[model samples]
Target: MNYRQEVEALQPQLIEDIKALCAINSVYDANTVAENRPFGKGCRKALDAMLALGRADGFVTHDVDGYAGDIEIGDGEEGICILGHLDVVPVQAENWQSPPFVPEIREGKLYGRGTSDDKGPLLAAYHAAKLFYRKHPDCRKKIRVIFGCNEERGSSCVRYYFEKMPACRMGFTPDAEFPVIYGEKGTCSIVVRGNYRGGKLLALHGGTVANVVPQQCSAELLGEPAEYEESLNKFLTAHPEIRAELKGQQTHTCLVMYGQAAHASTPHLGVNAVAAMAAYLEKVCPGPISALIHRKLTDYTGAQLGIQAEGQLGALTMNLGIAKYDGCKLELTLDLRIPHEVEADALAEAVRMQVAEYGAVLEYQAGRALILDRESKLIQVLDAAYREIEPEGGEPQAIGGGTYAKAATNCAAFGPAFPEEDTHIHDSNEYISLTSLEKATAIYYRAIEMLMAD
Candidate 1:
């Protein structure tokens, strides 16, 4: 089958679907909760519209409560599943020339929330399913398009659905980079909480989400702030890009630090405001928190803490996304992506030791990380589909972004993120080019077709 040709024919329709989804303000809003479903009314409404769209196309769609749902195409027997999420990261309209939610097209790129992270890929998968059904009306394997709504916050949506649905033989999540992902590092969120012992710092704050590298930090301090003002000023001069301030003309002031925000998965690519605050704070106010920064927060490349954790998949890294310390107490949350081969308990022990010095406690949870064998049919088939477009001959690599692939049987992250091309997913001005979208649809079509066969 000329899947690429079929994908080309559906390009206009694909773009229309993405625009329609993006226009719905589908970001997870907390206020839209009357029933405890986290994402607000608009996001839920957008999800419902997506399910409705699938049903309108003559497919059997199922809504697993309001958390997530799936659209089944083709009849009987297990087949390949195409997993994608409906939830999107919050948008900042001020950063873009056009509104972030409105999804404007300038210079051939679709600008909006979920365009690159998910909605674009979701539409591409839907068209691939549609093309599959159209081309092989009597196909043997059934195809399912899973729609998850709480992927960004937590995958509670899909977790609930999996409890009541049939298992997919193999699948791919179109939520990450292309050339496909062979391994996804283990994800663990560690938060250290303790008392500060002193009574000077008050109401420390930074970061909106645990997964986003905070671009700003603020802490209210007491006592002779002027004593440290000179040193703080020197520190600020060295890092001119950031905004640091000791608010007001009085000794009681709030120190604020600013940096560029980006996702925790790839921390090296972002400017972590939280880490900077801790680094300078450690030097200015030498203590457990600063020690934590030197040992853990400062290294996104995982070069320190004697945890240069690496494997055939990739090296582990930490993103100090959120921090709070009032001279009397402190709390730090770190997002870690570890190789599958590494033991979670062992790593947790290492972290436990670090926080133990200050009587601080650590809390951790393991997010799923699937490593599809390179020799497996699933990887081989997926590789063929990607090679058809980019013939650079690079093997599928590992990633830190968590996806639905780890939710069930044999699956890996495929497409939406082309190799070596960073569109800055989970950051401001997130977008997917028209060319990339088309290539993704073509790849998904071929992959779905090939993997569904006996």
Candidate 2:
């Protein structure tokens, strides 16, 4: 029952795979991906690389069209799927204490883009699965360590994988917060587009991805430079979270504001540069963009805009993540994580109402809330494993972050990030403590054992 010894034993080797995956910087992209790239090329290679490692480690592995791949350990009628992702978020390296792509360890913490997000934890699970393969190769069930190339973008990898393979009898994904997770907020991505009748703003750009709170925003202006410079400075000053810089004279002015970036599900935990820019624009322009944001963009939770929709998980969260304006054409993308009970159209209506002032147009919509059976055998098994680790009764909760579990039934997100530790995933200087990664691997090993053993 004591798995800590096993987890600790794998520490040295698990660090190697975590470092390998982190060094790759397989950020989501089409160029880095090939024709089979449902998500992108870097991800595809990352997927293949992990599967190759699995095969090298003496597991039966398969790569499914560069979308997703699986490594099978043991033989059986039913399987336990340890799901995780090989892809990572695009890192903003300028502020990092260490070069992002180059993995570094300091004070027992591994630092890199994917260190805590998934790669580090995924490797832990990978190593854990290997232990089971060696210990009980003839077990009644199998352990398929599943990883995807596109968990960050569209999860077509998992979707495609499930279509090609079989669902797990029960499983866990180490891709989110932990002790345990009982529910996950619903998730939605919407693109709201509109045309402004040639405003003073030339081009405005902000945000790295729809799932992240924009840490920076930049805008070009066609106004009397003196008129707004003072106001802009005041705006930036009032919001210390946002760093604003001005370039060019008033005629063709450009302003850049830097904020802190974190996952959109917890926007209040981080600052959104787009919000600061919108605040200033609301003062200067009072047009659609400003009004739309004013009405919609609340700090973090979806309290404002009357979108305080809540369900079994928690309050719905909406992030006005990306924004841009090219010569009068304004485009914005929003990320929302709702409960399973919320319908896609209900979310759309809420968004449509918020942006009605902008005369916002819908460009695209994707993802509905996905829910797994909380009382199912998979959850019970995973919960028992988590309980075995933490006997003091810290309940298994839910979250807004999406994970590989969504791709299949009877799967839940498990983890390396303990409830007490914060490794700064998706932010600058992303790191995972050596202690945490080791602990996660052991937990994964035990969880796999209970489900895969006859």
Candidate 3:
């Protein structure tokens, strides 16, 4: 069918669809939540836009009460699903060069909030399905492209959809890197809350979401501004990866630190502002909160808490994603990606024991990890399609980022982000290369065709 040629012919329409979806700020908003719009108005709008596009292309579309939607092609009792999300993380507008919601193309890259993460890749997969259906009208298997609205905060959208609907026999989500993703690490989020007494730390705040490494943290302390500024400068001189600023009066001062932001799944790629701030505060406060921060939470490996594990898939990583300290109480939101070999309950217990010494309690939620056999039909088919295009591509690999694949059965994360390219999924100025998007469309088209062939 010459899938690459068909994709090239439809590239313009595919890019326009991606831009239309990316224009909506789909971050979940409880304030704007309504009956069908469980996530928010923006997410609902994104879902509707995708469905409308499907209908325009003469495909059967279904909206699952705004939590999720799907476009179906062909006819069959069982179908193959292409799962993707429309929701994106909150953005710091000041950090971006261009408006985050407004899609822009510069140096052959599309820049926007969800461009690299899922929106662009989702549209690419959707268009690939459309092209396949156009070329093969008598295909045996059906193709269902599922658009989810709550993948950023949690996969509540798909959870609701699956409760009302049944899972597909097999599928792939265009949310991760190329080649293929045969294994994904287990994911867990832990919140530690406690009260502390007798410390110079009065109030501290950082981070916007649990999946992103915080870029900035600000703390109010009971100290002279000049003294704090001197101490901060000394600290920066020793550890120059972060930047610090001091403000306010002599008696009470606010200290702000800036660090690099990356996905929580790969905390080593980022310099966490919360961790850096806590390190500095430990020297000044000498309290339980500071001690916990400096001792257990600062390291990305969770070595001090004795929860580190290296399995066949990968090592267990940790990110102190969010931290806030009010006058008397402190709360920390931690994101951990664990390998399948480790037990989530045991890891939580280890962390809980460490935090108990500081009079803190831990709340943990664990997510399932996807581990598929390398010789399975789904992985073999997707991997064959990928290698067909790039003969030198590596074998299917594992990842730490959680996707809708974990929410659905017999599904895995495939393509959109290539091996050598960094799409900046959860960071400022996220973008996707035009060439890569087109190539991914071709790969998805081939995969869908191969799966549906009689």
For each candidate in turn, the TM-score is: 0.91, 0.93, 0.97
Q: List the residue pairs that clash in candidate 1.
A: 32-40, 177-417, 178-417, 196-328, 196-329, 201-327
* Winning model by TM-score: 3
lDDT of every predicted structure (CA atoms): 0.79, 0.78, 0.89
Q: What is candidate 2's local distance difference test score? A: 0.78
* Candidate 2: tens digits of C-alpha lDDT, residues 186-208: 67788888887666767889987
lDDT by residue for model 3 (1-454), tens = 3667778999998888889999999998889999999998999899889999889878799999999999987787556899999999988887898999999999999999999888999999988887887888777678888989999888999999999887878999999998899999999899999988666888989999999999999999897888776677889998999988888886899888999889999999999999898889877667788789889898889898989899978999999989988888889999999999899999999999999998999999998888999999899999999999988999899999899988898898998888888888789999999999989999998888877763
Error of 3 at 60 (Å): 1.7
Q: Candidate 1, after superposition: displacement of residue 400 in Å? A: 2.4
Model 1 segments more than 4 A misplaced:
1-5, 29-31, 34-42, 92-97, 197-200, 223-233, 244-251, 283-288, 301-303, 326-328
The segments of candidate 3 whose C-alpha lies over 4 angstroms from its true place after superposition are none
Strongest candidate by lDDT: 3
Q: Write the per-residue lDDT of candidate 1 for residues 1-454, one digit (tens) a residue.
A: 3777778889988888888898887777776775635567866887788888988988888887677888888888868888888887765465566777778788988888888878889889888888988998888778888888888877777878899887777888898887778888888888888876664555678877777778788877664567668988888898886777676445576788878778888887888887778777777666666676666657886566556687866888888887877666677888888888888888888878866876788888877566778888988899998897778858777778788888867878888877667776777787898988888888888888788775
Ordered from best to worst lDDT, the candidate numbers read 3, 1, 2
> What C-alpha lDDT does candidate 3 achieve relative to the native structure?
0.89
